[model samples]
Target: MKNLNRKNAIVMGIGLLMLSVAQIAAHYNPNMPDSYKGFFMGTGLGIMILGLIKNKPKRAS
Candidate 1:
């Protein structure tokens, strides 16, 4: 817990959230809407990317 910095924590959290959603989707009925599934996966990817990439801090020398 203490070892987890802000950026790492955010990324990990988002990754876990995405994973949970994917797991649920995977076990669900195939009758689900493609658009909704796509949207959830896409949004999860986008959020994960934002948390990992956009939240990175610049190195100072």
Candidate 2:
């Protein structure tokens, strides 16, 4: 139902995020400062939090 759809969406979002991170890493310059790493980690964490917030809660039935 709706819960299943929500879960699927979250999974898809996570998958996309992972792919994006992989692509960035592949082309990223090694000499860059650690600030870039911090930014990427922050973005990943923010996405995870967003997914958690969007998830449906279980019914009390």
TM-score of every model? 0.61, 0.50
How do the residues 1-61 of candidate 2 rate in per-residue lDDT, one tens digit apiece? 3554666577657856865784577467676666776676567667766666657676799
Question: What's the number of clashes in each of the models?
Answer: 0, 0
Off by over 4 Å in 2: 1-28, 58-61
- Please, what is the whole-model Cα lDDT of each candidate in the order they appear? 0.70, 0.65
Model 1 residue 57 distance off true place after TM-score fit, in angstroms: 1.8
Worst lDDT run of 10 residues, candidate 1, spans 49-58
In candidate 1, what are the lDDT values of residues 1-61, reduced to their tens digit?
A: 4544687678767876886786598668577787767777777777776666655556898
